[model samples]
Target: MKRYISIYSLLIVLMFGMVSCEDLFDQKPLDSTPAEDILTNEKDAEALLYGMYAYFGSEASYGRSLSTMLDIMTDASLASTGFSNQLGQMYAWKINPGTSEVGSLWGNHYGAIYNATFLINNLHTIEGDQDNLNRIKGEAYVGRALLHYNLVRLFAKAYDQATAATDLGIPYRLDYEDVTPSRSSVEEVYSNIVDDLEEALQLLPVNERYDEETFTLDFANGLMARVLLDMKDYDGVIDHTSRIINNPAFSLSSGQAFTDMWLKDSGLEIIWRVGYRITDANLVAPGYNFFNMNNVSSPLLPDYIPSDSWVNLFNSSDIRLSTYVATAATGYGWTSKLVIKYPTNPDFASQVLGMNMPKPMRLAEMYLMRAEAYAYTNNDEQAVADLDALLENRIENHQGVNISGDALKDLIADERKRELMFEGFYWFDLKRMGKGFTRVPQENTSTANDLSISADDYRWQWPIPTSEINGNTIIKQNDGY
Candidate 1:
């Protein structure tokens, strides 16, 4: 069950650090600590910020697990592959983490929530430049909101305009409470997500040196666009992405530079990302922040090959195909798999998984979001132009596309799927349009392999985590979990 804190106990435990307080208070403490107590120095404060990145990187969260889980679960007009079982579970609307990885997603996203709460609950106390304090707080706010968004997608139903007002969602928590907490409604969750973005926008500077990690205001805005898009708030989508589209830092990379740039940690497009740490134990896959696991950070081994479908998506002369891949012959064999983005550095010894993890938001996507908003708003010219701008830069034989009506919309959606494959946007796209998860387009059945559904089942919204139900009796669960 969801647990909460008591207002009083949450404070004493703040500066004092974690101690045995079970006997001291009957209920958990809530938000009693001020921000000053959080940091003794800048480094201490910075260290605390890393917790947000870690939370996002956890297997249950966006890290490798989520990216893989989301894609395999979808039937993309392609036949089923080895990852089809759990994928079936997702496509079918039957995912109970009480027994599977869904639990990990619940655990990790909340871990992010807990960390963000701790930091935001205490960020103000650090007696530094007010500007610095505000930046940190702003980031914490964005991080907290982003984590909540991740949780809601996995735990609550899709934001059905008809039922969202009444649908239950994960509990909304921003303070350091220790009391058992319950879930909120889906509408409440969306409201909270938007609220956080607004606050984060206000507090976050237009730009900053967030070390090799962290999200900026533009990044937060991009995320806001995504959340709003899911809620069917098309105007909100345009309003948010426009902030970055209005800015110059966000642009599509072209030619070899695009391929080369993806592997770098400090590129202009990344609004936020989990830095790759390359030690065997910490080693993780390399690829886009997209959902497809086919994109590895390392090159393919002697016989290791890509999914035949992923390869055939583009033609022999198409740009993305050759640019994004490498044979066993490339780069000292450090990366022999997909190696879609960052690869292991040749200089590092005792190699492990690359720590350069995924980012929830980036610049390349900003263009697509803007294009989509324009497409739906009936601005076909702007829509095609924006998408063309991206496509021209990505593929070699790419000619400008002229599309109209539903076919155009579908093409745009397909373009996004091809461009952002592993980044985790496909399923969300289908659901907002009330589509299905099946590739065969058989029928809209809920179970995996039924082949009836369009891969659009709202079941992707994860079942409520056990901790919430078992711990907080006051809470309620979503239906069809």
Candidate 2:
């Protein structure tokens, strides 16, 4: 069992660097040490910040495992036939407090939150140049908000304007605390997210140097666009994404440039990507969960593939079909179309398995968000303009056309699915829209029943982990769990 630390003790140990607390989720207790006695420098402070990123990249979080689990939760993909049975219940919508995925998700997200809290609470003490210190703090705040937003959406009910004040949201951990805290209201959680993002916007660099991998002005704006979109704030979505879309440094990539963007690290369209190195041992590269025979040789079988329903969503003329999907060309006939979105990082050695990076927010998503916002606000003219702008680069010799009303809305939603599938947005998108899914029937299994979930199904909200409820007395489990 891992040990826990009191809030006060952890903060002191963090700066002193006397404890082996590199991992954010480290449950081990640390010996009390004085910060003044330890060597506090910029490098030590930056190391802690990078550790937070490592936590997000862990298998339990954004790395291949979390992305794959979320994909299976939606209709876009499914757990491969031969993969672990632990996720079988998730794909089948049998989630409960006992579900390990629920527990893992809870743990990983909170772990990141705690890491951010430690940095934000104590980083000011580190002797660094004033500008660098403020930038680091801004990154911590934005990172905290990102983790909180993701946690709230999954653990709490969808953000309903009518019920947000009373709806149960995940604990908004912004400080170093060891006490079992109760869930906050959905409204409160979102408010905290916005406050942090706004602060990040002011402190972060408007134009970041190439060496900076931390969140910058563009990333903050893109994230707020996403959060506001979930909150049903269409006008706010446009406001933030416009800041990013109108920037000269970012734009939509077409043809080969778009294809290379996915395979390479940095690109014009990338707003911010969670990076990984080739030598990072046991790294849970999100791409590793997808098909890449060169790196992954296990069961010699792909763990997850695009469902027939998802495959049919793309058109032959659309560039995504070629860029995102590939033929398996081997045994394992669950689905013919394999995922290549996080294909291979060609810059790394072919033998490397964990080189694929996770792009959390990008320029393309901003355009799509802007289009959705326009569609929601009844600005169909501008809506269609944004849609066509994105599709022009996505499709070959795209003949631009205008669309409006319900037709325009449906097209925009479908376009989002095509543009953002397998990047961990499908399930969240469905939740925000209050839509459920029925998996496209598998051709290989005539006896198999297609999984169906209705819009009002209770399972739409995942159960809070049993361990948490047992430990935290003030915590109330979600209903019907």
Candidate 3:
């Protein structure tokens, strides 16, 4: 009973219109207003919806943990010697049901879900512009789907056609009611995600020039493409990616433009990015885990540095080599290659360090997903075309490659690693592809030890939080927890 009480604390806080002292929800506490009267007009609904987005971008979600966890958990990066140990437990693969990070992540995601659900359930009661109302409703649906999609991927086994129906997934919360529900199957959760995305497409405006912060038609399609890829629906992946690829508003960034994208957080390739402002309370930069700039002379006090093997994968000719990786002496003796992907945005550099916005969906990923889907469907010509198209934008003087069969699939996987490393995708790719890897110790770092993770390892599916297990009578823990 005590365990159950805490599990619903976040939902109750949201439902009661109370805001935390830390401003975690980024909204004024409706201390004077009744919870039932909070969403009495369009203005109230809009505020609620914006608050949901704020929480989604909070450190507990994409601003930090969700964006960097899997990257550190796998071989993409390693904790440096004498590091701050911010996510050291995850870096060492020492996770359990009682881990604080796991619980915080779980609570944060559900908190955002509750906000979205509340707006979705009550928005219809208020009268407003039909278009405005629809837009808010649509964005809420997309937000819910996006949160659940990430939750399912992290908590359940990789979507296996034969086993997905039985695999436990995080509960797909759709209402504001206080009820403890059993975990849904991976298949059911995914089905709900798809339905939400499809519903978003119908209600969201069809403008190509939508704000990077808002959910748009392109964002919904791009997300659907990603979801379909994970489910191994090749035709569906291709179909959805093609819609975004054909849009002229989004194009792959290259050369100086590409470098600026990471440093300044501006790019045409970005379909949806969480916007972070300097004025926001308790702002946590997504890239701070990789590169925390202390001062001009040393500048880097990174919690995690790029793994040697991953750094070796990039060629000097590739623009990503320069943009993503930089060598700097820590003033502690040794010079190491650091992940500078999330360096300070120029506008906020004076006030903050390592403050770039998180770009979750990009045009480059669309090309990668389409290429992989094409390869699987035996469309070798189209697959190579898509691969070379992306490579040409990324690699300098890139000559086109003629490859097919397993070779094409391998190339696509490698390219994904190169393009998306540190932004988070390493472990999930391994899980879905049924592959394992060994982490070799980095130089001069006793903390960096050799660890091999097998595809069949139970740790691939994160343990359900112990609090949830104790609170919800029907919730089952993942295997080996």
Candidate 4:
């Protein structure tokens, strides 16, 4: 009655002395060293860590499905006319335990957890530079926390103080053991996520700014802030977010710099991102979910477009409106406004179009999180200041606002939608806010199914994958399917 993950294969065992891939992201082993000789030195440990990063960059994970699926499931985006059926099931609210996207997301996230836990468990056995080893181990913990956090968010109910203690959560796997474990409570899963981040903060280097490609102290703190916000620990969110805000290394990107951050994947605000090299074999660009352009002259084929209501959320003078949304011909009969947040990076256009990096942690998010937390805590003045600061950077000729109470809170929520759209926060934001939405037909697009989902719908919690339930008898399926 143990949980099982089909991560380790004979080829992987022979090739990398750990989990090897058969169909998992079609990835190859980073090193061909025999399983028995793996983790014998510093290089081996780093190789294993790299394998975890590869999983992060896979289409099954952040590279595409994780973000795209969550977005399309919400009202913020709709399937375009003559759209490819990519994630159409999720967008239409027709997913079940047997859905392919569900199964892939479940398995891929667990695969990442396996890699992180393997690296964490074995890294200490290798003698290396103490500082470097600590940093690697720290990154592994952060990866584990991130993977589990995503799993719980997708598979379990949104964290509710009244019900989370009794609600089921995904297994918080800590080691690479072949033991079957039952799902933990939602509260327990969130607690473990925070614990992992705390460990990462201790081990990660204290620096002004770490490379955006690597996890650092700021990344750990930023993640903790997000986790705390989810748990409704407003004070805790303020404390962690303030740490990153005060640091001189990070600032909000504005004007042309902000536009380049999305198009070029270069900016001062990116705290950490899943980076991709043009030569990498598994390179599924995040933008491929939204639009595709073979060349500058080619017509854009957008699989999904922002909903009319969502498009209307941004003000005309807001920089995000111009930077993120663009109207283009779909190569079909109609033209539509496309989400260009992950547009092609000019540097890699010749090799791979739409190959922008996925920025999971950013400085902009901190201000939004802090503003929400402050509003909840009755710190109206500070909340408004945060809102003003963020708006000043995002809007052209933006004026400061003076507001408090529920009005300020409402503004913060809308601001989050405007600022973080398409980066995959819509559905989850709706869930945590205890709100439901209806997807109405857009003026130009009649393809929207007009789906209405309530806050109390069982579908809010995605069903545990059928394969997982069948493989691990001890596991319980989500209530709906």
Candidate 5:
């Protein structure tokens, strides 16, 4: 089992890669005065707060980096598409320790962190009404903590008790500094993230909604569940996820409502996600460099193709098959791209599927998290109850789908496999369970067999970006990478 060790070092390199060589803290003012000074009132604070969310919108956060990496590494079986190429060719991923992509992810996360730090530190100074101040600050804290958590997960491998104390985690950047910060151990990163969120969970009052369009208590709670789960604090995971699940305010949806989960300003299972209008200027041409969707098709790469077995795993009635794949004319004789997963075609950046935003936390994930935590805590009966709830919704004819014992756990994991496939949970799930590089090499297709993934690949633990080692004096490179 390959672990992405030394998450902090990898992050250091990746964070700096987001832009051209320059000061790490270079701030391109939206209108001139530094955000620190301008954000002195409700209106400015509101704008600045929303600006922090855009960090998630960056290709590194949800747009491409983490999301793409998550999908490619999991068993959703890549759609026979060109976009899948960068991921499928494990050899190709820059995260493959010491690659430019790894460097980019490092730089991107830190950049987001820098923006968050600025907002977080100055929230109080902004002259706003009690309601506005509390609301903006509450959301900022949670959002900030989450970015820290996200960085840790991608850079550090599982919290191995044996080595975590010494393992390098992503640098814990607390302020808006551009100096060389060395990596901390995995334990240090999680402890800091936990500390941040604990304070956040307290600071974020239950109210302060945004345009009926911002994060609320539900989002923070759901994120806390995720953070706990990543920490393997199964009991804590249960506490938060169960709250989100049992809350009458949130529930699963069907038909268009389900798809709307990804829509901008829409709320269903999603509690919080990134929001990128098709019109955002960040949209740029592909092939020309720096995160363009158009460049997506222009440069063809062969990635994960649905294996006969993996495809067969989905019930024929499962609508996701159509949602996740399309007939291809290129690699594997199928259109080599996941056209549907990025289900929306905005006039702005049509390439975005599931909207331009990434669902940072959602109710559906909470349900799954609770079920998994139940199983881990030996609450079999409760686990079954939670699992059935999810299955009933997705399965077409759920009347008699019998499952028991390991079979049941398999079903639940598979349910997650299908339900949460491309949303970015699969790879982490596989790695946590210690499944080695897996590949669905062949089967039932008429003339062509799709190669899913080859097992034993070490590309799992992203390596420390090369630049970080060269530029930062305090940073130490991961061992294996």
Candidate 6:
């Protein structure tokens, strides 16, 4: 039988070649009629959009680098002593432009952005059902904005009111044709992100149109809350997150439902997720690396284990300890404690592969965002209420508490750590808060080693891939690379 994959896998053959790029940047994807012919057709237009989503889930994007690599790079998780040299380099804080990891990530995000811009540019000219056209166009806008948002946060300095206007942000590519673009100011890139997301809010259908895998109104708002949170716009964070929390369609998973959320094909709290099929051509290796916790003899056995400091943050009553951990007995012959957030599913045809889908935004994150916003704004009562409500789901007999000042703020921060540990939000959270971290070091000898990362370290801003530098003459490299 021919294996069926997500629409993204199929779209690679359908439209990727249509984009003619002499280098990573500076190319018209649809300069000729062949590309235009595809977009003019309704089904093909939607397929092109699906291609962007597929690229988003690729390892180069959220499937690995954004989620897995970033987790290992932080203090919350570590690379296995036997982890691959490529990943070891990333975890050791030795990231550079020449690393294949950075290059692939850069290509994946921009590739999605390129396709998204292509659709938004061409979709308007076609006459079709207004609502369907709006949804497609809206997805394109959100896709482009999302790619740029991730790029800017990783490549540029955290947004500073004093320096953002002058700081080197990533290029905001808005055109489909080949053009040499220079980095915009951090403020400019953020402004572009907000503009795109706000437009998405106007054009996108409500949560019902989400279909688990597609972007929706709530997703846009959740992302906006995240963007605002990173910008330290507390009121803005509250304003956006409230929209999702109040929505009737979403709520946190609790008890057996939460367990089912991970072990089965369910996403009770997901606002937007990336679709993944077991048969996806690129899915096998990453799925194996993250989900196959039962393999003890494998060299990758200890990868992505929760740090002692991170584990200590949780109380014994925390349900996540059991739900998220792979213990000595359950981890086959492996002895060290490990994370089983993406545990393998016995139900799948390939029982070894972790079949869980990647969720980019969820209701839990929105609640945390709102809680932090409240804490920062001195709304301690409201902040504690939000945290207690979320904790009620994760802890047994959880008694809610009310506190004020930094105590409330610290509680909110710890809540974020416990809630979003391996889903890829830790490093950014520290970066935004100006906090430093120390990696406890891997036990055995490997190319990777333990190191302390301070808030002001230049390494926090990832180097622009060397390949990108070699191809584009007008771009400038980040400092201390």
- Runs with alpha carbons beyond 4 Å of true place in candidate 5: 1-38, 78-98, 176-178, 207-213, 259-267, 281-304, 326-339, 345-356, 400-405, 442-458
Q: State how far residue 165 of model 4 sits from its true place (Å).
A: 1.9
Please give, for residues 121-206, the per-residue lDDT of candidate 6 as tens digits: 88877778888889888888888888999999899999888899999999998874446579999999999999999989999886
Q: lDDT per residue, candidate 2, 327-422, as tens digits? A: 755346444567778766765645544356777777888888998899889999888888889989999888885668999889888988898887
lDDT of 3 by residue, 216-240 (tens): 8888888898899988999999999
Question: What's model 2's lDDT at 76?
Answer: 78
Please give the distance, in angstroms, between residue 91's alpha carbon in candidate 2 and its true position after superposition: 1.8
Worst-scoring 10-residue span by lDDT in model 6: 291-300
Give each model a TM-score.
0.78, 0.88, 0.91, 0.91, 0.80, 0.92
Off by over 4 Å in 1: 1-43, 76-94, 176-178, 209-212, 279-283, 286-311, 323-356, 439-458
**Pairs that collide, model 6:** 97-466
Native-referenced Cα lDDT, model 4: 0.78
What is the TM-score (0 to 1) of candidate 5? 0.80
- What TM-score number comes out for model 3? 0.91
| lDDT (tens digit, per residue) of candidate 4 on 395-423 | 99998887779988999999989988767
lDDT of 6 at 462: 90
Error of 3 at 45 (Å): 1.3
The CA lDDT at 425 in model 1 is 74
**Which regions of candidate 3 are displaced past 4 Å?**
1-36, 293-299
Q: Write the per-residue lDDT of candidate 1 for residues 1-481, one digit (tens) a residue.
A: 1112221232233323222222111122233444454456756665566555555555556655556446545654222222224334454446673645666566556655655666777666567778877887788888888888877776676788889888778777766454656677889999999998898899988755344366778778888998887776778888888788777666667766665555454466667665544432233443322212332455322211233445456666555566544433333233232424334333222343333456556676887888888888888898888888788777676788877877778878877777766567766666566676433422211224434454444465666656556655666666665
**Model-by-model lDDT, in order?**
0.60, 0.72, 0.78, 0.78, 0.58, 0.75
Q: Residue 237 of model 1: what lDDT?
A: 85
lDDT of 4 at 455: 93
